[model samples]
Target chain A: MNKMAGSSMGEDTIGAIQEGIRNSAARMLESGEIDVFIGYEDGTLPLRTTPVFITCPEDAERLVWSPICENSLTCYLPKFQGTVGVVVKGCDVRTLVNLILENQVSRDKVKIVGVPCKGIIDRDRVGKALGTDRIIRSAKATRRSLMLEGDGFEVEMEIQDVLAPSCEVCRYPVPVLFDVLVGNESMARDGKDPEAGYLEVAQFAELEPDARFSFFAQEIERCIQCYACRQACPLCYCPECFVDRQSPKWISRWRGLSDKILFHLGRVLHVAGRCVDCGACRRACPVGIDLRLLTKNMEKAAKDLFDYESGLDIGGVPLLATYRREDPDDFIL
Target chain B: MLKMAKTDLDAFVDALVKASYVVLGPIQEGEATKFGVVGGEEIKIPRLTTRPLKELFFPQDESLLSFDRSGTPDASVDTSGVLASDGISPRVALGVRPCDARALVLLDNVFASDDYRDPYYTLRREKTVIITFACPLPGVACFCESTGGGPYDETGSDILFVEVAGSYLVKAVSEKGKGLLQEVFPPCILHEADDEDIQAAAEARARGELPANAGVPIEAAAAILGHVDAFGDSAWEEVYKKCLGCAVCTYLCPTCHCFDIGDEVTGASGERIRNWDSCMFPLFTLHASGHNPRPSRKERFRQRVMHKFNYFVENNDCMACVGCGRCVENCPVNLDIRQVLTTFARRELA
Candidate 1:
């Protein structure tokens, strides 16, 4: 039975998805279908969730499905041993797909439990609404509404206002591939020009060159150089990242504007064709710097120039690896 | 020693600015609060700063000394002339919390030991004055009580400020603090702090108690870590699984002081600089002979736990952590150190 009372969940169906995930995880574990199952569990803090590694069948009860499940669990795949089962949302599935393509993980050695995601809630927006008094005791979410209760106060907010920016404009809501689907498929996205895809990148490109440079410089200057963005990314699986290499030190630890710009731009270039735009890097960043713009532009370039969208098929060659006779080389001169 | 109206705080800071002290205060940068050069504006002290005041002293990157090895590998390296002078400058850091202050004292044991004292750290330590605000409301993640520090702990602070009745009861904690206070504010500017002020300060301190479930078991932590064989335990596997091996936790932690030194060379003119390092990174323990002692995340996480609880306690007679909770609050995957400690303690008891 669902424990949530007066939740006003209505036709949200997250409850059904939650139930489905727990059942599937338990059955799989008991049958020895997978060695470990990775999913999200309720966090101690309100409006937050933590990634949980389930090894035993009984521990599957701890698994949860909620709008607060923001992390892309696929990042854990490369490090996992033996046959593993993982939970993935629409965007997270892209990471799994890319991981398989990159030979980071074998397709047959893993099982994917894909979830039809509406969107994950942004904790910052919730904090902003609650303001300085973060004494939130409990919070419940429905498809369209979220209700938070605490000492002497309760706030009911439209879910749209609190949805993560990446989730809000998410084109993929249904997982592209899943061994077992947990929830009903989300409604198909409205028809749009697939070739002209990088809307955010196009908007960023519209800025004048100087304005663009200043924009990047101003944004990156706030970076404390923690490298959480790199650590959180699935594509950044290099044993020794360029920033960490001291011999030919590509970047310094200085907080200078040039160092900051180089780190962000350099990272985008390194993961040029492979980046899946899961927004994990931006979400993991404590300073909330918009690191998505540059990477999104790179993704756009890969798409427009090569007519490629990554992780669509595991057998397809990587964008940078393949060569075409008709490939545009106008800048070669 | 003195009672200052809350409104007069800004004026006091401005006076410090006029006195040629580079006054640093908690400044709001996006979602986080950082200690930055005061802009003659109101200081918005958040529940706690994301990065501790340790950065001001130990710094993420500092030039120890640069050498000129221009000609050949065997050429005489000139140590006399350094690229950046490690000069001491007087500065006042305001609005720091007690937990962060205590962590600095713990750091002093490492950087300013009797055997070898770091000049760069010592110079900054001598020149700067730290004024801390008694924490009124410690967050859920904070565990200062367990780490042998409290909300109003004055272990490392020069002055402690307690807000009472829209005014501050400022107590000079050390000789340096008292002298600075006297030089900045005349006798006429301050009134005697009475019984009410002390009572109010106690109440403020009480409000910052460590949340019950999240309390650090200092004795249990030390006991579990005390046994060398405990390093081979299986509990670390669970603790490290959720960790992304990110530097965020160590970088944000108040007590983690591991650093890596390297040279930035450009056509023979280069400076050797020290930058923050984290045990969570695999490369932190990598050897030149392509052999890493602690190659996996499990060993790395275990090293972090042992270093804070066991190693630091053995070396300095104090736990390295002051429980500022920046790590707990900022870990992307939400790997709480409190949980790890509680699990270890419970397992040891069992």
Candidate 2:
């Protein structure tokens, strides 16, 4: 099994890190360095995780770091007032950094405890790999394989086959910025080209315009106007989304082809340069729409034209917020 | 009751199609099972469809009426060709879960009420027939039994199918179902269900085919929830704390029938359309005067629960939620409604 496929780095490595997290959180809470410790706890559903808020030192044991901790806990920072200790993974760190840069969250109010992420396993992918709709009672992950126990029997499967598409291409395995680090820094995989992030977008760009539209339309058609994609994203903290506005209604929340198409385009455009490529929106989508295609195109455009990477530096001018004289405008009429 | 082999279902669907009945059933798309027009593909059996059958009756969006001004300076309003009315054809929704079928009945309380009758919903309800499959073992998140729904509960379905040892035992719950079955399946294909078949079906339900009981004090919770004063209770703060206010739960809910009507105008000639709306949205209760009652997520979330449990029961003498568990499965934060109900139940007891 490929080691980069979001499997547990080893029970020992994870156990030590979890212990470190609990101890650190408890100390912070006890010392009053932080009023609230935000972390993930085991979710009610199998292969899922839920964000937990710990205020008391004794509650720090509720915090756990694992491959299933999929939520970007930093999203909760803006909703809070006091100094909050947040457990963040690689993508969440970038999101937190971006949130700080955007002034959505105050850096002084947040104490970031970064967890070394191989990658977070996609729950849907695991279900697909298991090839069953039965509820998994429990799942145990080893270094190379994942054992899923359910109604009748347990099946051991290779982790690589079940890693999320985003995880397969993730560049940051270790958090670049952290107040406290948990676990040893993970090595980036050598077989995959981390720098070639826009390969999928480039490949899709090669398709004919009609084919591309059809590809996008078919995916958007499945959207049920849940808005979970927008709600789950750390960047989408707008008090009023355009779709929700009434005075100059941008788009209707309809399942019609036109409405679906317009909503997708409008959302992608809104988050063009601000999105951190966190994969939270795609993961949150219940119908499994390929949202990355749109977001990745925007990411590629930001990199190629503006020479910008979001959340890369502290307090830097955002791509869309500040205009550079060297900005590429060849496509402009 | 009549017995038919599972293999003969395709022929039943073909016969229904031949009779010009729009057959809507589970269509397997990638890893998800969604409800759509049957296309000779293998019908995904038992699994609760991602898209509820309610969409068949109350569509996501449809034009209500069109206005034309180009013909004459004064606009000529046309109400004759409302989009849904043009094709008010008979439909058979097969492979529906019992909870989903029950949800339609719950929705009827509002749409087909004596006080205000929705012609659009009424017409669809009259034209459609529901064929439900007895839900198999419930998943971890299911609590159908607590919400007046069960594996074999057949309150709203025209026909109910229970999986027996080797064949499906079908029971007609309504006159429409009886006529449809006789028309679709020949006597030679259907065997009179023996006592053994009925017994086995009972045994399946007795073995707890559905998930564990919810144990929520529905009666007490409903009573407490119905009070206007209970709206300010502190329980709402904890219950709605995790909610991201995305409307995923409400959109997927089979019984949620609230809609927003608007006009899609195009150069002075346009069509008035109705689209699904969720109470979870901040704008759902917003007024033109900039005043809002359920302004915050906490209030919005409480409104959802109260509407489902208290308001619906007060109006219709029945709970609105059918407990299909779609909300539980798809909630982005895993904010289980079952937990909320249980919490309220505990509060009521306290």
Candidate 3:
């Protein structure tokens, strides 16, 4: 979405969406409509983006809007006492809409300042992009190209080449619901283009049943019992968890094969109809594991049987909890 | 005096709708009564609903915010939301069981806290007035009077309607009830309830489906919950061995309000999402640093009881549990909650 203005339609502020963000943050705070503004600030890594809670409009000057940012800060919205302002993209707007649908927070209480992102710098992909020698010092992108300035080196790469794998299948690249939108650019990558999941699902059948079981067994054996998957998910909220169910011990957090399978399997079930296919669990893993395959299998099963997809619509009921009288009786017999 | 016959349920519904209010009544959906958006004659009315009306105000699942791919969140306005933000529209909830009506009042100790104000709940609550029906017959799981409820406990209702022979014996309790009675006064009959009838009604309550034998004193039950750690005295392993961690029991329970929020991003933008969660899940209490406080279903099961009985009463003077029995009836393994509580109370198992 870098294609900025050059003509009468393109004001100087339209060069990068960052300028507009600065203006909006200044106005929102000046108007007293919001107490704090959540925006993007620099991370410890020069090229990475971290979500920043900007209470001062001057701090808005320190904020930078770019593709390197990835956070769903809707969880923080409920904890705010007074008026709060937030930044959102397409997927983030879906979460906001869901919250609104549930009546957890009023739309009037907060200000939504939106930005359309082109692609974010994938840390894993970038490590492979420049090989092991290059240390990324700083990076910025125009509408078309991302320039990475590293230690004793400079490199230019196509935005698509550095985007995260999940972004490759991203459908909504523009803001779905926003109050004030920045960067009037949009892309409808609804996967009319070549998608990855169909190929993976097709290839899974080619593997024999024994091979599949062995493959899962081998992969699960390496599980270190870390719950990076749970932490990354926006939906795994409980005051306490069951992996540690002391009363009956449904699943243990130990590194045993049974424990690992139980942990992952039980987790997938809890998110059965509720999971929105965000790929956060797969991305958050310290170990590179294809955790998406299990979730995607559940997704395929839900679609094939119940004709359901999570987070597709704001008003649609969550599939797992709600039941129709006509629901299949597969488990009944 | 005009007598509104039982077959005139159409007129009964029409009469409520013409009263210029969004009419809500008991609806028999699946095995629950939480669904309360019926205003026409197609509505089903039973002697009592399995669940309470609290779900109407504090729904099972509601959204706090929506996030986009860009990591920005936009809060929802209304998709023709069931109720308006302001208190108007004159809502009348008909056929609410007295137990469910009292459950609404019980829920208030938590919702009406001085600290956090749930605006959505408060809005619907103020605009709506309850019209409860006396439980002509309780179900297999009811013990309302044993726990300070009766065949007709009345607190949150505006109008209390008793189903008699040909017409309804309507008792106006609140000013809103008085106003509603005036609106429907044209077809009303002034039949004063006598002492013998009230006494006969009280006696008839015993023969009804209510189990006064549920075996927990309402007053001391909350006190017994103070010893959350007292589970050490029982065999908890036998209690939860077959538990599959499916979380269906917690999801179906009327008062289980735990939820989780997440984000789904497509490129530069993504949406943060919130969905219902259960302590039955292994990751519900998992920490980012790889440590979990309650790392097994057994401990999670223990927490469920402590939170409902001990922690809830410790904080809000009332138990979070309404004894809806959804957990008991819907368990995949047929694990009854009566057995669980009985085991905790050290009662003789059948």
List per-prediction Cα lDDT, in the order shown: 0.80, 0.79, 0.61
What is the TM-score (0 to 1) of chain A in model 3? 0.81
What is the per-residue lDDT of model 3 for residues B1-350, given as tens digits with 9 covering 90 to 100? 12234556556667767766777776644223444667665765665554446656765434433333343365333323324433457787887877667767766766667876666567778788888776675543444555456666676788876665544556788898788767764553344566655555456544543554345454454454455446563566556643445565566555666666554334654334344567876668987777888876678887787777778777777676665444543343334555566556653223
Clashes in model 2: which pairs? Answer: none
Off by over 4 Å in 3: A1-333, B1-5, B28-34, B47-52, B65-88, B188-211, B217-224, B228-234, B262-275, B347-350
What are the candidates' individual DockQ scores? 0.48, 0.44, 0.01
TM-score of each: 0.92, 0.94, 0.46
Please give, for residues A19-101, the per-residue lDDT of candidate 1 as tens digits: 77888889889999899999988775666678998989898888887788889998889877798989998878887888888
Residue A96 of model 3 has an lDDT of 64
What is the per-residue lDDT of model 1 for residues B1-350, given as tens digits with 9 covering 90 to 100?
67888888888888888888888888877667788888478867777877778888888887766666677785455443532354355889899999888988989998988977987787788889999998766666777878778887899999999887798899999998998998888555567888878788777666655454236676786888787767888888788888888888888888899998877766766777888889988879888887899988889999999999889888888888888888877888888888888788876533
Ranking by lDDT: 1, 2, 3
True contacts kept of 1: 0.49
Per-model C-alpha RMSD: 3.2, 3.4, 28.6
If both were scored by lDDT, which would come out higher, candidate 2 or candidate 3?
Answer: 2
What is residue A208's positional error in candidate 1, in angstroms?
2.3
Taking the tens digit of each residue's C-alpha lDDT, what string does model 3 give over A1-333? 111112212333224577777778888988888988877654433444445677777778866666666555554565457887887766566556555555555778878877665645565577578774354556665555667775478788886887766566555656666778876655322431223544565578589999988877876765534465664555564445676555565653322578788888888887776564556566555445677777767766676668875655756676765788888868659
